[model samples]
Target chain A: MINLKHTKMKNELIKPQGLVKNANRRQFLRMGTMTVAGAGLLLIGCNNDDDMVPAMPGMVSLGTGDIGILNYAYALEQLEAAFYAEVIKGSYFANASAEEKTIMGDLEKHERAHREFFKAALGTNAIGALEVDFSSIDFSSRTSVLGAAKTFEDLGVAAYNGAGQFLESADLLLIAGKIVSVEARHAAAIRDLINPGSADFAGDDIIDSNGLERTLNFTQVLTAASTYVKTEIDFSQLPS
Target chain B: MNLIKLLDTICPDTKSAEDRDRFYSRRDAFRQFGDFGKKVALAAVPLSILNSIPHVAKADTASLIGVLNYALTLEHLEYRYYQMGLDSGVIEAPDRVIFQKIRDHELAHVRFLQEVIGNVLNGTPVAEPGFDFTAGGNFTPFSDYPTFLALSQAFEDTGVRAYKGQAANVKESDVVLTAALSIHSVEARHASMVRRLRTKKGLDTVKGWITNGSIGSLPAATTAIYAGEENLSHGGVNVANLTGIDAAAVSEGWDEPLDMNQVLGIASLFLAN
Candidate 1:
């Protein structure tokens, strides 16, 4: 019922074939073969591509289980990190105040770190690089840029709030909690920047009268992401 | 003979033989009889009847994870809404910085959930598409600053309520739950900002804090505001369930859970047909 088969397929795609079976034996042999000659040879053979080779494609697919949910968060991080990177690379707003520039720069750095953190944790299982289409944005204008920024910040907070329940691993959930809290802080900061005294930016839109948050399935989110993303995402494994 | 009758006819004989045979002698007979019994049982069932039953789809876990997905969808919609506003040349220069930061944060949130999904499932699911926040051009168009501010206020307010409604689903996971609550607060902050912006511009938007009278019912003055509004619905979903939450308590410190149906309906406002 949980679509174990779909999860299994995702697992098979993420992990290199035979890694599980030969892990122990390979470790033993590697330890024994860690000689000075081997070390020198390895150093000489190491290539930059090995470190920077983009993670395998589709490794971020969160199969229908809980881990699938975490991957969803990771993929978003990839997009944010990339967006900030581009923003920093091209400071589009000519009139951007020094303070605004600094804050934006700091945010970019933070997003990058968050992205790398997820990538490291996910290893070869991380998702492929995503292509974001921001053509609709007029980066040259402060108004257009900030408008998009507000949307991103507010949406980030809401998304995290809605998806927090699916985490099964306490450790992973703890890390997510830490990261999302920071994102919330960022959201508040953005809100205030847009309008002073708007520190309490959230309202009935995000939370209901019952004091509870909303939950969404993968289908709902993918529908929204389809606009900016060029690559086709296969969420078929997600629980319907 | 019908399958039931044939089984009934054969069953008695088998039972009689089984009862009459002595213990040692009846062992082989019993084995044969047992095999026959199994065959009869299978033969008596109709394959066509079994095939006719529809296979039910398994229910997904409506836990914190489900709730987060719901939030993620909302965030995506908001992100797009603001993007459209900024891109369409409707916002003023002063407001541009404000919306930019908000957009950045929304993207961060989208990324955050993507991370969560990846971490939880160890892979990224395909992102969904086809969201139309304008609702097929039915609601107040966000063509100008006033309309944009008002619409943004509605979107932000809805986001707050939606987050409050789904809090319980994630309570089981303390870490995720706490993070979600924190995000909920941030969404609240965004809503308040939008409301203040609207109020400043002479729009009679509700205050940041909901009053007792605001609970359980739409204010008489604003009823017409959303009536027959197409933007209120998301993918054929309705917002009726959203009224179930105690709006008075919304101003209180505690986070309120939104009705799933209501959240889905609000989400539909941005859903692409």
Candidate 2:
């Protein structure tokens, strides 16, 4: 197995850090732009023609139609991959039980695979690598790490579920189906690690009385993920 | 004009009782076209008749209903397995809650699919077929805890793949597609928990996500469940060597889909003929 610690250090050196360094200042600017963009969207909604607006700088559009949904999934996978990469390097995981270590380690790889799959499949059309800000998570504590993992995994499942209907391509939809279940498996494992043998694995919070998991719209999911991601996502083409 | 001959023409793989039941349903569907029904011999009804008839809308509806019925069939099998296992007293505490929760979810899935078929879609829901968890007396899941866990893993994993295979079939209906996706993830969660339980009980090779189709100590019957799961390619991309992680982890990262025929073949094992 590749040493995760060595890889983390290598990532820190080679991966782009310039964007993350200015995340705080850029986030403020992005928030202002988003408010204006939100108003602009409302006005555009009043019009019948749903033509694509030309690309805007300092902002990333998820694209239009099936490509839009694929980019949306790509964005989420990037966030998840980044989060797990950090989790494996944390002190808590470094000293965890064999079972916990195995779960966390495998999670990182699975998420990375998902991330790379989308990137490769999307090719030129794929969205750029996202910049995630997970400073809120305390990696030194097991509860904190697992709690955040639970949140990401649940959100990922819901996002994929909601986005499936938007994808016009059956092939792309099948690809999404392949990844979403793995995300759910990751979610359940993390939940069990927190409360072993408990009903929390498929807790009522996420699963409804009808035995279905929750589905979240693009807007809902993006809003929740905004706290962790520094990159401003413009999903105007994606339906709410 | 025998129904058996007509069914053979329609579905060549009608070798099981469940397959026969599917054909019987199709027979009823054909009878609904009253004008065409009276003129044509049942065996002479060509598959292309659907294109000639002005039933395109109805045809689409039938296909969607067909997909949902397939899903409900699997859910029925899982619900019965867990329900019987719980009643048999093979599942004890700690583990008991896991199976109980899984049982309730499967039941909910059954009810939800039934309501959608009957009320929302205005189609007849498929009836729950009889199940023999013993798989023709090959093993006793209800009496043996390890056997129960093994079967649970296989069923949950199969449920995940089965729903995935049908996603494209239901893609035309946004509501149905979304509902199916929601259920798909829950099945994965169940599969993961079951696998974890197996690991905790000394099946050390088992992991939440399948690794290289490794069945660990599970019976050979379940080898089919993990078949094709070792696939390392996705969307034309070879992912095995893409990530720095081991190839096994890469395979574990993505769950593969099993098409309708393959899923039915596996489900047929438990179907009470």
Candidate 3:
């Protein structure tokens, strides 16, 4: 009975909000236009919405249960990896030296690996690729780009730390531990690049005088995430 | 209510009522009644009695989950703060990059948590809630960069300590524990960067994670509260009771952890008026 209640509760939580009324209207119009344009493509190979990449601003449905959370992480890695790749590909920074370029490349590779690893783990349940809008970034300047890099790396590290406690499975936790540490290293390296002699990265501020790490709840994290993702995420089903 | 009734109310799925009755029978009836009466009376007591009972929820396995939620909440706060900073146009070119990167990192963190809850924990990620960064205008407005930095410093410093405080909850799960701590270090790095920025801009950066103390000068109240307690400090440093960290010792490297109640209080700063 307890398990049944849990299941029911989860189902209610994960039920995707039917597309917001306004969004649905927009989507209907867009789909109508696309259908006319791609009728030939559809006949040739494409199926339907399943094959179509989810539109921008669509929530990444993690589904119900633990699998949903993993999908969520996978979805995020996809975004990060894609962003860094573009940043590197554009060579957005002015006066980019070889060393900095190499580091950027490494970061890109790590993000890609992170994305792929999750995709492989999730298999069929993996989220569809997302379309990112980076219009706000001024990629031409080194300071602008690297500064953003530092923020991303740092946020990644803290997110992992905060989320680690909620993991129930030992195996998954182990995997997360490895990935989070790597992200931490990334954060440290980025911090060092931004400001020299300031990598006193792991101090009482983070660990506390008691030698412990900090943690946060999912609702808090998702709210912060909402702005950047452009996609609305519904985490209503997660355990309180 | 009788003890059996209370137990049933709390855990409705016990294997057998007989088993529960038997379990309660092991204790002295008179003594148990006294304890139960005390609990009942406490429940009816007003806010004044709160301190006495402390409302300290007993530590349980679920605490691990609670700690994670707490950490996630901090990331959400940071992400929003950076996003607003970037959009405000007050931030300069270099600062804009910094804020954007922070924004990305926060988004990544949110995604990571979403994955863990859905996959490993077999739970759905919690829905996002509305957070008011302005804490009822208790402090300076976030629209000002200096004010924003101060709040940022508080958020980052608190994040560092919150992770540390929750570290023990994950210890039984070594993998999760290590990952949590790893992230904790990264939060410390973020706090340091923000602090440096504040200092560079001629703000009082020392009030953040470090305090000056010597044979000549006594620690401030904030410094004193955090003195030797850096291990437990989180989010906002008790600026009035600050303490410095030794650059040498590994364990002593971070600031002290704050009490969970203190953390929640500070978090309330971001709540809407």
The prediction achieving the highest TM-score against the true structure is 2
Off by over 4 Å in 1: A1-60, A91-94, A210-215, B1-273
2 against 3, candidate with superior lDDT = 2
Q: Return whichever of 1 and 2 wins on lDDT.
A: 2
TM-score of every prediction relative to native: 0.40, 0.79, 0.42
What are the candidates' interface root-mean-square deviations?
A: 18.1, 7.7, 17.4
All DockQ scores? 0.05, 0.36, 0.05
Query: Which tens-of-lDDT digit does each residue in B96-154 have in candidate 3?
Result: 65566556666656655544333333234665556776666544435577777767766
Across B1-273, the per-residue lDDT of candidate 2 in tens digits comes to 122222222321335666556445655665564345432432244444322222212565678778989998999999999899989999876688988999999998998787656543446789999998889999899888888888899999999999999999877767677878989999999999999888889855698898888877888888888898889977666787666667899888888999999999999999998
For model 3 chain A, give the 10-residue run with minimal summed lDDT: A1-10
Candidate number of the best DockQ:
2
Candidate 2 stretches with Cα past 4 Å from truth are A1-57, B1-57
| Candidate 1 lDDT, B90-117, residue by residue in tens | 8877667667656655665665665443
Model 1 global lDDT (CA atoms, 0 to 1): 0.49
- Model 2 chain B weakest lDDT span, ten residues long: B1-10
**lDDT string, candidate 1, A36-124, tens digits:** 21111111222222112122243234433443454577666766666666666565644687646755665665565555555545444
- Model 3 spans > 4 angstroms off: A1-57, A199-213, B1-273
